[model samples]
Target: MNGAGCGSCHSAPGVWPEGEVGPSLDSFAQQTLIAGRLPNRADILADYVRNAPKYVPQSGMPAMPLTEEEARDVAAYLYTLGRR
Candidate 1:
């Protein structure tokens, strides 16, 4: 459950450090798509995390190869980061 990927670019509340390559997950659940097309559903997000290159040939996001459970956990965590 160490979804510390959240710490990669985001730190100390809403401040995303300058020069960070990845976007902040602080409001990820509110977003509509992974990279503008894929549904932002937990399962879909998980798949994207595992196979981003297959979905988008030229994406700057790299695949994380997360297990289905990990993806679900991460997605759940992301969902909670946004307002209801």
Candidate 2:
């Protein structure tokens, strides 16, 4: 997610800048829901990360420009948080 700018809003372990705008994603894998709404399933999370506004209309998270594959990759990585 180099240019995707996820780190600009969320703070994930090892992700630079440690953003404070959005919720921290350090324990994302343990979370049961995405943005406190949708189920935290892999496919759903992937799409949501790419287009958060679609899932949560009032959310501050903007739509990412990543492709399907890149979004999937990002979701997969996010699912690994706090598992180590």
TM-score, every prediction: 0.71, 0.94
Candidate 2 on 15-76: residue-level lDDT in tens? 88778899999998999999998999999999998899998999899998999999999999
| For model 1, the run of ten residues with the poorest summed lDDT | 10-19
Write one digit per residue (lDDT tens) for candidate 1, span 50-79. Answer: 677889979777677578887777667667
Clashing pairs in 2: none
Best by TM-score: 2
Q: All predictions: root-mean-square deviation over Cα?
A: 3.4, 1.1
Report every candidate's CA lDDT: 0.66, 0.89
